[model samples]
Target chain A: MGRWEPNARGRLEQAALELYVERGYEQTTVAEIAGRAGLTERTFFRHFADKREVLFAGAGTLRDDLVSAAAQAPPGAPPIDVVATALAAVAAPFQGRLESVRRRQSVIEANAELKERELIKLASLSAALAETLRERGVAEPAASLAAEAGIGVFKVAFGRWVGEPGGGEFARIVREAVDELKAVAAGS
Target chain B: MGRWEPNARGRLEQAALELYVERGYEQTTVAEIAGRAGLTERTFFRHFADKREVLFAGAGTLRDDLVSAAAQAPPGAPPIDVVATALAAVAAPFQGRLESVRRRQSVIEANAELKERELIKLASLSAALAETLRERGVAEPAASLAAEAGIGVFKVAFGRWVGEPGGGEFARIVREAVDELKAVAAGS
Candidate 1:
C-alpha cells in the first residue's frame, strides 16, 4: 500500500519499526519489511543499508547539528550553557515524535546488537560535540566532561519523554535534566 | 617459556597483549597467543574463553568492585562522592599496570569490533553503578546522571594516565577528574 507512497523512506521506516516490534528485531527481515511497506527489497535496500540503519538513520544528522550548535554558541557562554543550548537545538526536531521514538527504543533495548550500535553512535556524537567545545577554547577534561554530561542529560530526558504519557516538549525536559545534572554534580 | 609459569593467566594476558599490539587484534590468533605464552591452546582456553576475553577479563571484577564501593559509601554521602569513591576503588588496582593498559587500549582503539565491545562494557558498568546509586536512595535522573558523569571522569582520567608519562596514581587522577566534572557541571 505504501510502495507508491509519496514519502517512501518514511513509509519503509514505519513498516520496519512495526514489524520489528511485532516479530522482534532478529526475526524481521528486509524482504518482510518491504512487503509490509508495499515496496520491494530493492527499495528497502535503497533506503536503508540494513534493518539496523532504519533506527540509526537520524544519528548522523543529529551529531552534525549538535556539533554545529555548540560551535556557534557565544564564546563567553559557559560550557554547560553551550552544551545545553546544543542539546535543546538538536532535540527540537524530536518533538511530537514521542511514540516513534518510544517504539524504536524498545526495539533497540530488546536486541544486544542494536544496543551496541546505539551506544557506539552515542559515543561518536559525544566525541564530535567535545571537539566542538574544544574548538570554542574549552580546556581538556572540561570539554570532554561537558560533552559527556550533555549526552547523559539528553539520554535521561529522552527516556522520560518517551515513556511518560503526554510528556512535555523535548527541549523543556532537556532543560530540567540539565538542572538536575548540575544539582547531582553539586551534591544537592 | 611460560608453560610451567605459576601465573598462567598473567602470562597469557601479557602474551596476548604483545601479539595484539605487534600483529594487530584481528591478525593475532588464540593459538599464537597460547604458543607465545609457552602453553597449549587447551590451557589458554582453560584461562579465557577466547582472545577477546583476555582483553576484557577485568571488566566483571571492575563492575563488581565499583558497585560494592558505591553501595558501601558512608550513609548520606553525596551521590557524586559515592560515585567518585567507587571509581577510585576500581581504579586502584590499575595503578602499576599503565603499560599493559596502554597496550590494550591501543589494540581496542585500532579495531572497530573491539571498540564496540569496550563501549558496551563501559555502558554495562555505568548501568550497574547507577543501580547501586539507586540502592543508596538516589532518585531516577540523579542516579543515572551521577553514574554517567563518574564514568566520564574515569574515562578522561584513564586516558590521561595511559597516554601521559608519570601521570600520577590512578586514584589521584580520578579525584582530579571528579573535581573537573563538578566544575564543568557548575560552569565554573
Candidate 2:
C-alpha cells in the first residue's frame, strides 16, 4: 500500500463502530478494526490513538464548527441567541446521519468510559462556547450560564432526535429545544 | 478497633480529602487515609468502595436531597422553579463547607479520571432531577431541559462561589445564577 490512504480516518471510524456494535466495545480489537477497514494497524495508529478515538475523533471538528459559528454571530445578538444559533448551525451536518449517530450513541451508552468521554466532549464544547461569548463582551456567569444552558438544550434535543421514531431533523429539534429552554427558564 | 466505628464514614471522607489535598489524590493510599482517620482499612472499605468513592460518596445523598426537595415543591410551581428551588434547598448544606468543597474541586480538577467521575455524578443528578420533574407532570423535553438547565446554573454558581475571595453563600449564588439564566434565556 502507498504511504497515503484516502479517507482512512472515516473508514476506521465506520469499521470500529460496526465492530463495537456487533462484538461489543470491550470485545473489539484495534487490529480487527484496521483489518475491517482494509488498512494496516500501523495506518490505524497513525490516524487514531486507539479504538475509542474512532468514536470521539469528530469531537474536535464539532467543537471548531460550534466555536466558529458562535464567534461569527451578530455582535449585538444576546449570548443565549448566539449560542442557540451556533447550535443549530453545527447540528445541520447531522441531518442525514441519524442511523450512524444512533448507533454511535448506543455504543457510548453501553459503556461507562465512552459515556464519560461523551460528557467530557460536551463539557469542552461548553467551555469553548463560553470563551467565545466572553470574547463577544458577555460578562461572567452569563457567558458560562448561557453556554452551559445551550449545551443542556443540545443534549436534550439530541437525545430526543435519536430516540424519536419518526426521525426528526436535528437542527429543528435544537431550535425547538432552545425555545423550550427559554420557556422553562422563564418559569412559564 | 471493634466492628463499630463512630462516624466512620465522615472521618474517612475528611481524612481522604485532607490526604488528597496534602499529598495529591494519586499518591494517597487507602491505608494512609485509614491511618490518618485513626481507623482500620477494613473500616474504610466498609464505608466506601474505594479511594475515589470518598470524593463521590456524597453524590447519592445530594441526589436524594434534590429529588426530595423537588418532589415536595408546591403543587402548582413551574418545572424550572421547582428545579431552582430544589437546587437552593440542596445547596444550603454547603454553607459552612466552602473550604473543603474548594479543596475537593481542586483535587477533582487536577485529575482527568476524577473529573470524569465528577461529570458522571452531575449527569446522574440531572437524570434524577429529570425523572422527578416528569413525575411532577412536566413533559418530555421540558422536564429534561429544565433539569439540565438547573444543573448548569448550579455548576456555574458553584464554580464562582468556589473561586470567589469573599466566600459568599452557596444558596444565594445559586439563586442569582438561576435569575441570570432566566435573563440569558430570555435573550436580554
DockQ in order: 0.82, 0.93
**Per-model TM-score versus the true fold:** 0.96, 0.96
Candidate 1 off by > 4 Å: A1-5, B1-5
TM-score of 2: 0.96
Score each candidate by Cα lDDT. Answer: 0.90, 0.93
Candidate 2 lDDT for residue B125: 95
Model 2 chain B worst lDDT run, 10 consecutive residues: B1-10
**Candidate 2 structure lDDT:** 0.93
DockQ of 2: 0.93
Per-residue lDDT tens digits for candidate 1, residues B31-77, read 99989988889998888999999999999999999999999999999
- Interface RMSD of structure candidate 1 (Å): 0.9
Candidate 2 lDDT over residue span A7-122, tens digit each: 88788888998999999999999999999999999999988898888898889999999999999999999998999999999999999999899999999999999999999999
